[model samples]
Structures are given as structure tokens and as C-alpha cells.
Target: MKKLFFLSVLLFGIFSFSQTLSSTLNKTTLALGEPAVLKINIENLQGKDVKSAPKNELLPFHLEETKDEIIKKQNNYTREIEFAVFEEGKFQIPALDFKIGENTYKTIPYEIEVINTAKKGDKISDIMNNKEVKLGLKDYWQLYKFYVLGAIALIALFIIIYYFIRYSKREKNTPKVISNKTLKDLELLKKKKYIENGNYRLFYVELLEITRNFISTQYRIPANVLLTDDLIDFMKQNNTISQENEKVVEDIFLRGDLVKFAKTFPDKETMGADFNDIKDFVKRSSKDIEFENIRSDV
Candidate 1:
């Protein structure tokens, strides 16, 4: 009776101790040069700090420590380590040793299979001599030379006729230059009573978009998508807009942003001043258009 009781107590202690440390592999199979994870979970650490295992070069694996997390409720500590296998074979990860409060414990070893992705004993030379194929127009050219020439000539004639028709239609339908379009759009926008109707937001939005579109068309700077500062930077970098004219454009954009985003209302005088400034900017920037207008009038 006394021996039976002692054996039961001893077995229980061993079982509890065995449950304290455990290790697992995320995947047992891997391809060469691919990484796998090794998880070491230690329970009932009792607030003792633990140190990771030292890397061993003799093993068939390369080990790297990735993460260590602590679970306060369960008194558990988890260490995540990464392992990469370079050689293709079946191997076992050696037991990883951990130290806690002058006591050393080791995790169970895990077996893994590393597969080779490359073909064995295969070389470019092995395939180079196995097959030979000849391809060219020379072999069939003599038999169908006249037919081929006729087809090519027809294709050439069709292309010439197609381009001639396209050119004639384009000449008849080509719209006026961008400057003329911008001027007409501005004139139409000015006819709207957006400011008088308390639609300052709409007024500024249209104003800014029109100016940005003009800049995009004239300078090709994509000003429509760029903010005021970015537009200024682009212009400065390219030296496209003169410094004085750049300040005028910046002022207009700033006021427009305030009206559009901040809901600020500007007086009629201010609106009129900005409107004239835009017109002046367009005229000065598009000298070629102004010259053409002058020539047409003369």
C-alpha cells in the first residue's frame, strides 16, 4: 500500500513537469531555400527570464530567432524562431536548450523534409542536341512568290488609301487650338451668376478648374491633379512660368481653395479682380494665340 501511493505521487510530478516545455514546427515539409517556423512554448515560467538556444552550425538548418511573446494569464512564454534549410534531405532539428533560473530545459526535436526544386543531372547541353528544326520563308518563297507579292502590294495600297481618308476627315473636323477653347469656356463661366446666387463654392471651383485646365493644356504640367504648392514647384523646376506670373496664379489658387474648402465668401470686387487676373495670365502665357488673333484680324 505505501509503495503504490508513492509511485502515484511521483508519476503526477513527472507529468506536470513534462507539460512545462513544448516545441512544435509550423510545417514539417519545405522546399530548398524556403523558411519554416519553430515555436517553443514554455508554461509556468513563474516570472523567470528565459534565454534562447545558441545557434549550431553543425545542424543541417540555419536558425534565426523571430519573436518572443509573453501571456500573463497563462504564465506562458512563446518564442518563434525561423528555420531555413539549404540542403535537400530528411533531417531532424536538434533539441533547443533554454535556461530559466539556474535550470536548463530542452524542447523535443522535430523532424523535417526539405525537397529539391531543381531537376537533377539536367543541363542545357542535354537538350540542345536532341532536336533540330528549320524555319524560314526561303523554302516556300519560290513556290508562292507571285501570290505573296500581290498580297503585299494590296496591303500597301489599302494602307495608303486608309491614311488619305483619315487625313481628309481630320482636316475637316480638327477643333480650334486649346487657347481659343479656354477663352470661350471662360467667357461662358463669366456669364453665370454664381457669386450673386450665394454659390461661392461653385464659382471658385469652376474658376480654379478652368485655370488648371489652361495650365495643363498650355504647359503640359498636369496642374489639374496637383495642389497649389506642387504646381508651383513643378513650374519653378521647369522654369515654365515667370516669377511674377507665378505669384498671381498662386494667389488665385489660394483664394479659390479657401472659398471652396473653408466656405469663405469674397466680395464682388475681389472676385472681379481675380477674374481679370486670370484673363491676363491666359493672354500673356499664350503669346502664340494672341499673335494668331492679331494676324487673322489684320
Candidate 2:
């Protein structure tokens, strides 16, 4: 009875192996040089491990490459397989056989066909017997636009560079106005021997005009409208003159006031101090001032 039971168990295992471990390829036709994918699905396998195909009369095309994916479901395994074919001909993919425990199973042979490729344009040997033709204006303009755009970009680059250089040079060469020199030029006129000798009053008038001209250059305010009090107020408001310089400036205004209205005659030292004061005022104020919109009267 135990011998009979063992024989039944062996027969059942062999039947299970024969049902599983089967594979198949999908397509059988392909163009020459074109790729053909062969999918081999193995179902209800006991163990995954598949053996390499035998090198016999089968597989006239190159194997190229093979890829496999395994999936486990409940109590069985399935292997999804891919094989590539590269050569041209009718070919047979060889049978794949594998053993599960004491029993083995094998796949049937699959057939495939590879066709030739179609030619494009014309054969080069045939074209060697033909002649060339000339191209038209449409083709000429298409090529011309590329060169035209390149030339425009170059001209724009040169214009930008030239303008920047010219502007920089103009700024560097511009001259600043000297406010203190205008006042100093006035004082120097007063110090001349001619003022003390014959025209003392004329000296005072000239000194006044020099002070007004200094104000014009330094402040850009018209000098003709400014009186002694107006000059003092302007200097105070603008912070242009220092306390010491304002005092000297005021003294010159006071001296000019006496000469213009009261007709007073100051001694040479007194007169000379006022003259020096004008020189000092112009010297200090000129450095900080600019003459705007002034064309050279000279």
C-alpha cells in the first residue's frame, strides 16, 4: 500500500511540471535592421531559474539581449521575458526547458521572419548619370538675412563705444569759475598808486563794482541788485562767508557806504585794508562756487 501511495505522488508532480514552464514570442515579422521584441511569458512555475538556450540548429538570428521580470502570486511564480532579434531570415527561437524538483518541462519552437528595407531618394550610382540645376531668389534671401543681421549688430556696437568716449573727454576738459579772483582783481585796482594820487573816489567806486562781480561768480546771483545789507543777509543765509570773513566783507560795505553817501576820506591804511579784504573774500569763495550757463565774455 505505501509503494502504491509513493507512485501516485510522483505521477502527480510530473503532471504539474508539464502544465507549467511554457513560453511564447509575440510577433514573427520585422523589417531588416529593424528591432523585433519576443515576449516569453512563463506561468505557474515551481522555481524561477531558467536555463540558457542550446547552441544547435535553432536561432539563425543573433540573440541580441534578453530581459526578464518575475512575479509571485499566492502559491506560484510567473516570469515575463523579452528577447531581441537582429539578423535577417526565417529563424526559430529554440525551446527553453527547466526542471522543477524531480520533473521537467519545455517550450515549443517559435518562428519569425525578417524583411528587407526600402530605398530612400535615389541610388547614388543612378544620380551620377544626372545633372545639377540652379537655385532661385527665395533661397538667396534666406542666406542673405543671416549676414545682414550680423553686420547690423557690429555697427550698433561701434556707435555705443564712440559716444561714451566723446562724452568722457568733454567732462574732463571743462573749466571751473574762479569767484575769489574777481574780488581780488577789484582790490588790486584799488591798491594801484593812481587811486591814492588823483582819483580816491573813483577807487572806491571801482572797489564796489569788484565786490558785486565776485558775488555774481560765487553765488550765481546777479550782483547789480545787491546793496551792503543785501550782501550781508545773503552771506548769512547761504553760509557762504565765515564769521571772520563776513566781518571783513561788512567793513568793505561800510567803507563804500561812507565814500558813496557821507563823502568821508579814509587814510591809506584804512583804504588798503578794505582792498585786502576784497582779495581775501574772492580767494576763499571761488573754490566752492560754479558759474552756471556762463559763456566767456572774454
Candidate 2, residues 250-295: lDDT per residue as tens digits? Answer: 7887778887775788777777777777776666663333322232
Q: What is the model-wide C-alpha lDDT for candidate 1?
A: 0.75
Candidate 1 clashing pairs?
A: none
What lDDT does candidate 2 reach at residue 35?
50
Q: Candidate 2: global Cα-lDDT?
A: 0.64
TM-scores for all candidates: the values are 0.39, 0.37
* Clash totals for all candidate models: 0, 2
- Taking all chains together, the TM-score of candidate 1 against the true structure is 0.39
Superposed by TM-score, candidate 1 places the C-alpha of residue 211 at a distance from the truth, in angstroms, of: 1.3
Q: For model 1, how does the per-residue alpha-carbon lDDT over 32-124 read when each residue is reduced to its tens digit?
A: 878787777888766777766444332343543333343433367776666587777887888777787678888888788889887987754
**Model 1 spans with C-alpha error above 4 angstroms:** 1-176, 288-298
Per-residue lDDT of 145 in model 2: 80
> Best by lDDT, which number?
1
